[model samples]
Target chain A: MTVTMEDVAREAGVSRALVSIVFRDVEGASTATRERVREVADRLGYRPDQRARQLGRRRTRLVGVTYAVHLPFHGELVEALYAAAAPTGWDVMLSPVTARRDETTAVESLLDHRCEAVVLLGPSLPSRALDLLFARVPTVVVARSVPRRTVQVVRTDDAAGARAATEHLRSLGHRRIALVDGGRAPGAAERRRGYRAAMRAGGLDDVALVPGGPTEHDGEAAGEALLATSPRPTAVLAFNDDCAMGLLNTVRGAGVRVPSDLSVVGYDDTAVAGLRAVSLTTVGQDPDALAHLAVTRAIALAEGDAASAEQVVPPHLVVRSTTAPPP
Target chain B: MTVTMEDVAREAGVSRALVSIVFRDVEGASTATRERVREVADRLGYRPDQRARQLGRRRTRLVGVTYAVHLPFHGELVEALYAAAAPTGWDVMLSPVTARRDETTAVESLLDHRCEAVVLLGPSLPSRALDLLFARVPTVVVARSVPRRTVQVVRTDDAAGARAATEHLRSLGHRRIALVDGGRAPGAAERRRGYRAAMRAGGLDDVALVPGGPTEHDGEAAGEALLATSPRPTAVLAFNDDCAMGLLNTVRGAGVRVPSDLSVVGYDDTAVAGLRAVSLTTVGQDPDALAHLAVTRAIALAEGDAASAEQVVPPHLVVRSTTAPPP
Candidate 1:
């Protein structure tokens, strides 16, 4: 029950092509024709579609971002991305991936908004799926690595981060260090490999790699698994901050004192880990630097520059109250 | 030098109106004209704008939600909203408010996307600004109360929630209960009033109101102030979970055990509050029910149903490891 462009064209007695030009604000129509079309369109109650009007014009200068709503780290990165994009004359459009919204749906919304480029924050999608996105739009994947050499990437060296966490616990006189692995979670394999390599380098070949996920509940379950293991580890390096927090909490609740009984180190020094109550020793990813690089690459690609290279940001270990010399 | 629709029309030897029809997939253009326009558009690489094509004649069926990216509770509510919108044949579009993006910009982006209605999650904007938006679009404000009778609001009874938290502390046999007030934050005044009312009803009219903000650092500072008081309250209610966690950590570090020596309670039972280590007893705002109500009202308003009414959902207290009978 809505008025179409055809209706306006017929009423105005002009070609539909002329009306399209007037609405698009392009150079095809004369000023008189433009005014006439506008009058007729207004008379017909044509609700102007911004996207239609802006099409074939200059750039929208919009950068789309897809992030998981539940991840606190993603929240921090999104804040950093906004700061990064502003001075560069670009606006950020967020399409959050919630429980009911998938990455494809979220990404498509951004494209629908006419965003020139997209920055995907640690997406857990398959390589084939990413190839499709890269083919369609200029994409920069953050916090996760992609296999395709042609895809641009801005991410942390997950293996190095896990190594730093493992080495920190080892330096604190912790001998039996166990890794709470992230299983198939993004960067999990790299983290697991990093932990194993660090332990082997420390001359502790026997590794205790317990399966964990990206949630606090997973961390709690992993903590129980650790408690049940015959030779309890003196220290544990968790997949991420949430898991580390859960593990730390469960062990404490079971009468095991942190730093005295178990030295726990978490990845991604999220805001929660720094709380006085948690004070989790964790690895920190540089959100600002990573975001800056991502936007830089995205803007370059959007402006018709080639960007098939990857930029790796280093992670730093933050020693907090949760980690100390193993008893 | 992006290919415009004018170029496609000229290349296809068709009127611009006919080209627009072909691209929009709407009636009025013949099969031959549509095929010719499609062939020309593909050859010219005229990137079709989705939003432009989905205009008029029918609904975009999009419900836009504005939420603060930094809030964990907001994250939960957004997930709930997505689930609520999916069943009603409506898609959810997210515009996250970060440090760089304000509420105005967020809402405007939604409008630009041609969303039928907008749902703002606890906006701290002035009433006058909201009136401007209300005049332009169908808006529903969630988790925040507006004084305007005509504004549609779906929110928790914050005063009742605060009162429930205070009453729970009093029932646990704590006499000197201090209220850590969220100074100038959204719903702070109502919460303060509720706390005061509960205190006055119990004949504990000499209220210990501590100035606090919504962060963990604020709670730590409030905890220091509480420790310095001559007769420190046996129980304290914080502005939020983050503040309560900070206060708990600081007090415990100062050799004051929780619940045994002092009791602590918080508002907004975020994910972190439920952790066994930070088992914060806090008030729960039902995101599922609130999201359902907000979407239902938004769809109604979008469908021409007038809604100047406010719906207040009740909040329940979640008793966790943080609260116990005061010694």
Candidate 2:
């Protein structure tokens, strides 16, 4: 049988209301009474029910995170979010989005847990769904931007990063540079726009844009497609590190040497990108900076602050063994 | 602006008790009354406070998970856990242990959030801490064993897995084999015992065990040490896949040809192990099975069932490009 607060109050010879006030830690009861009630509760193994306390109080001080378990980049962001939330005296409540669990389930679980706000990492939810969410609770979308200004966003400048990658190849005397399209992935349009702008600026009209995705298998398929194209691109910029790695492996396995035959650059310099075997050149997003800003903005908004504009962080290229002057 | 049950009751022209019964789906209200109350509540945007309902109920149906965000293996297990818990109608709450957040803090926060049970993934907590935690709330420790038989455990047979890895190397006609120790990590001791037994069984007592750890950096250091020994071993069994990848990279960087000059086998066939560039031969633990058993045990324990015995899952070795017969 579970011991209740009423049992603790009876044992302590105090009113149930006084015990409740002490448990809530609000301005109430004498110090001596508080200590006595705590002692009684401990002796009786009575715990103040977390849910009951929420009904009696106004704050939970929990910041919920909705991130994909499969994505290593999201894992890094979650760790950074914990560090960022530590200083604000708010706890992080994680509700992971897995293959079986959808975004709505993840967000609803957090809301059900009484989290003051939520942080969606690389969310794939539609704008209208996000709008419905923001209407109910404060939300911050990280690593992706939504159309509405009403939702807070902390994201990397995809266009600039894409431009930098393309220009890096162009400067290496590679005239035929290609970009593996991310399809409808968040910020894919911006990267495509950036690549086109860079190619136009370099007077390189033959832009090779092949359909790809954010995974390794997608990159492998894209690699086959690239290899089959007439006047194949000497260089390819992948949507992300996984795609880059897949493409690198496929082309290498097919007797095309990386850097010497084809140069590949990946985005989101994840941990795998730094593996000695996979030494991928890619764009690095600052997880700590983005996480810190997102947490700050989320806490402020939860405290009834006005909706703020989107905050964009700059991404830089990390050169490694995968990139060299095109053959 | 929060909507209260009082507002719903007033709008529906019913008592607060009637509204509560309707939301709780209890047997108090008539069919018409329940429908009218729900309609009024929806119009008022009155979500039943999750916390308040806990005070009025006996179960939460929440299984809290304590895992490290930095570990890919943990990420995989978390995904599996979500899949496992779905059939049981329970939701998982993740509380990741980061560099700054200790395991105790992680567990306590979940406790404060009203989680009914906890699943510790590759937990590094000492026996005493675990004992306290298990005593308070039902816990299932996955991928690791604890001291007490009273506590529920769902783990891989580490010794069996290690023995298989050693025998795999031995069958390749490699007399000189080394074991990269996991050094105090869970299952490290069992692996050591298994390797020692295998060496004795093979009558090839050239046991070369180098101190290592769970991370890739530790493997690099172990690789350096292994390379320094007189009459270097031709085959090495690494602690885990990350360790194996690191050792492979480090030795390759030092100009050692893999499989011809040295053969490597790793434990825990993580996704990285299957990469075309790093096709590591490794022992594979089935995450789905372990997760299923763990959720079953945890939910059962939380439901007032007697503590069941530890559940052991078998592990199999996956042969890839990294291992071959001795040169």
Candidate 3:
């Protein structure tokens, strides 16, 4: 059984109203009485319910966020969210969707905290749940496409990003380029569409799509599988920077030189891609634009503006040392 | 500017108790009345106070967590914390401390959610603030040492871990080993102490301590500086895996082969260290053990168990491709 305010009141020989006033930090409570009430509450393991207090307030000034802890690119976007929220006098509360916890658990906690609005990054929730969530709170979904006008959305043009990466590799005179797929990740299917379109555009008859997940291990496995083929691809475009790093390292470990033997391109252009040693050719998502749009839309909805908006930003190719004319 | 339940009651011509029951999803309200009240509430943008309802309950079953979003190693430990909290039937609420958001903001949000206790990972708060926080709730500090008996603590033996890394390099016929510092991070000072003690114990008179920070860029800078010396050190032990990766990549980019020209060792054998592409030799902190102890201690303290325990776990070395007999 949990301790209650009533229990604390009884223990401290005070009325429940007095205990409530003290817990709320109101001026009605005297100092000695406040100290005594706090001591009694602490002894009884009682905490004043914060959500209850929030109900009586005019504004929460809080933006609920859902992000994956393991995704490096997600971390960058979250930092950007803080900056965007700062000027608007809004603070962010993060609820991480980890391997052990599902997205529902994460989102529910945000609702329980009475966050004014929500921002989801690369959310994997079903459309129905997302719809329900948006209906419950002002929501802005980032880096994924949902039905138009269902809720606000800010996403990169993933297909264009993939196409640019493929075209860059093709322009380097590489005929065979493989794409390490992101599996069923938010932008995976769109990126695949872009890759295929670009391959056909370049007049390449053969297109290879390797099975891969979002992690570095998946990229390593994909690299190994691609290398074992009778006719290896001359270049590879990975799912993201992490997968790209895995593929790049695997090939280099097998005594194959990067760019000189096999050119590689990664997506997301994360911090890792720009590392002096990794210097990967990749596609870039405009985080600043994405952050600005998401925050603006979220705050608008929270303030009861109730206008649904959808914005798609283009991704650009970042040419680094990872690509070269195929050997 | 927020709508209250009283406003909803007046709009729907219902009693306050009826409105509360409808919002709470409890009995004593007809379907027609519930719908009417809900419609009015929605129109008014009124959300029921969840925290107020929670005040009547015994347990939130929540453990608040504070972490740095950008730290990859911190992500690993958070995953471990979730797993550790699972069997105990507790859920975690995360508040990320990003570049734009300070630790105080993160911690206060946790308290607002009425979490039973707080678990801080690599917190950078002042000692006085930490003391004040612990006084307010059951707290467990990880990866940083605090005054004994003030609060429960679970951290790796940093000095020992650093000493072990130094000794391992020394045993590999490397007399000129330098320490790349983590500046003033949680475990940096202790690790530096261990490095110095180990260097002195190894009978090496000339010890090199390089100025480094916790990021990969800092490591890269230190690597470049070290390499510019007339007779560069044979081996370098970096502040953490990020810094080590920075140093390793810098040297490798400059055509200095690992284990042949410059052997590198990183700390905190993070997920990155185990990647085949970056098989870094580093010290391992048992995240599972640390997580289990921290959660257990936190729950106990929350339950009013007054016993204060401080535990220091051992750090072991994992030999990988980054380190070998120095040339």
Candidate 4:
């Protein structure tokens, strides 16, 4: 027969209440009693009934993280979060909110698991849905910023990153700069706003903005569009590294030399940017640092410290082989 | 006072047993009764006390997945598993096991959360640890082949995939081919055996074997080593896509043209392989299909279908711009 908590208490020569307190690690149980109970329980091969304990405690210590689509760097961030949370005795659960599955269902499904907190990465959920989710659990929104103050936000400063990219190009004497805008993606809007703000601030507001997506194909399309322009921008600022790669290949395929014919800048200095073949100049965000901050803030909120609601992380530019002064 | 199950039952004009059966969606509950209970609960704004219900069932419908390291593709597989399991009313929890935290601690931590089953992805644990895990709960092993008959196994046909990669190179007029090996990884041994068998079968047993790892840096190092050989290999088969990319970059950096000076083949046609810039010739394993199969099989095992212990999925090769006739 399977052993019970009562059996464990009898084996340890302790009262059932003491055994309960020790197993639960609740206050009022002395360290000596706790250690003794654990020793006897280990010797007896006793494991607390998880369901019973969870019911009594009313918390799961499980947090749900949802991503809109599958991207490699996004996966890296999730891995970082997992590494950060594991040491804190919390586990992260994944839920992919695809177009087929609406945001409400995703949030409801996580709620059903009794997760004490949630972290949404590049979520497709509308603001109302986010408001509803925040009402249900302590939530940390990553890679996206919402207007509400109820939810905590953790994101790389896209506007500042974009400005740095523009200023880098300007410093290289590239007066004719082009922006490949990532249309309607979670971070795209903020990035676009940053690019525009930076261009205007740098007296380059006349620079063209080409509509694009986050994929390399978008970069290719943007390259084609730029090539057709009467006077192609000597330099291009792509949406992200993937898009920059697309632009690089497209330009190279057309016999255009990088940094000689056209300088290019990418964002999210992913592994691809540092590749010897692709040596892309891009903006870098420390995923590990961001993940640590988000998870730490989440634990605090889960532990009932709800006053801290927002945190912003800074981004920096990494110079590589892809950028040079315009000829 | 917070509303209880009894309060919900009274409000719905149903017995407490009927309310529970309806909420749990037990097989015995009729559709009409289920609909009535749900409507009443919704109207009364009654949210089921998840903790209390979790206690009664002794199952959280949560499955914990543990990974030794966070490789890019592992993230895709985890996301796929989450998407697959969430629809079936099961949530996928992640436990990132580090060198500091052993497999036993990770497994026990999941057990403490009342996970219905556990899946270990590319675990580095010894067979004895695996045996202990399987004894505790329904367990599934992914990307690893274990000798134990009790634990269920889900893995790609790496041997077959490697054989196909080698044959593809041989068929393309490549006589001097080298295999960049993934040393000591779970599936690496099997893949190495396959490559050797295929080379011998093709009457090319004289081919070189270069030691490597799953990372791009490893690929670059292998490329340097191959370049040092007297008659450098005209064709290279890398351990995986990331490694292949590294090799491509390193060779190109040394002024070698891909498919002209060296034809390259990669294993695991990940999303990066499909990128226009990479266009990597590699082996393809359907991550979504594998994840779906693993989760379904795990749930079945947890639900008392312990008869089947192993399931194998086939791998296919995808030819892209990277492979051609040897110089």
The per-model lDDT (C-alpha) reads 0.85, 0.87, 0.86, 0.81
Q: Point out where model 4 deviates above 4 Å.
A: A1-4, A24-32, A82-91, A98-102, A148-150, A275-277, A296-309, B1-4, B26-33, B45-51, B60-62, B82-91, B97-105, B147-150, B304-309
- Candidate 4 per-residue lDDT, tens place, A204-280, comes to 86678888778888888888887888688999999999888788777776778888999999998987888666688
The CA lDDT at B88 in model 1 is 91
Task: Pull out the clashing pairs in model 3.
Answer: A51-B51, A52-B51, A52-B52
- Which regions of candidate 2 fall more than 4 Å away from where they truly are? A1-49, A227-232, A255-262, A275-279, B1-47, B148-150, B223-232, B252-261, B275-279
Write candidate 3's Cα lDDT for A1-327 as tens digits.
446678999999999999989976779989999999999988887865555545455467789898898898888888888889888867687888888878998887787667889999999987788888888889899998875448788999999999999998888899999999999888898899999999999999789999997888888998898889758999999998888888877887788888899999998988878877678899999887898899999999888895665789999999999899999
Error of 2 at A49 (Å): 4.8
Worst lDDT 10-window in candidate 3 chain A: A49-58
The C-alpha interface RMSD of every prediction is: 3.6, 2.9, 3.8, 3.8
Q: Which stretches of candidate 1 lie over 4 Å from their true place?
A: A1-50, A58-61, A111-115, A148-150, B1-49, B54-63, B88-91, B111-116, B148-150, B299-307
B139-187 per-residue lDDT for model 3 (tens digits): 8999988753476789999999999999999999899989998888889
Name the docking class for model 3: acceptable
TM-score of 4: 0.90
Clashing pairs in model 4, backbone N/Cα/C closer than 3 A: none
Judging by TM-score against the true structure, name the best candidate: 4
lDDT of 1 by residue, A1-327 (tens): 446678889999998787887876779888888899899888887755555445544567788999999999999899899889879967787888987889988887787667889999988788788888888788989988877546688998899999988888888888899999898887788898889999999988769989899999889989989999978999999999989878876886687888899999998999878877668889999999999999999999999897767899999989999888988
lDDT digits (tens) for residues B1-327 of candidate 2: 678889999999999999988987779899999999998888887877676666666677889999989888998899899999988878787889888889998998788667889999989999788888888899999988887555789999998899998999999999999999998898898889889999999998999999998988778888888889979999999999989877886787687888889999999998878876567899999999999999998899999899878889999999998888888
Question: Using Cα atoms with residue i matched to residue i, what is each candidate's TM-score against the true structure?
Answer: 0.81, 0.88, 0.79, 0.90
Instruction: List the candidate 3 regions with Cα displacement exceeding 4 Å.
Output: A1-50, A58-62, A87-91, A114-117, A128-139, A146-152, A229-231, A299-309, B1-50, B57-63, B86-91, B111-117, B132-139, B147-152, B299-309
| lDDT, residue A48, candidate 4 | 79
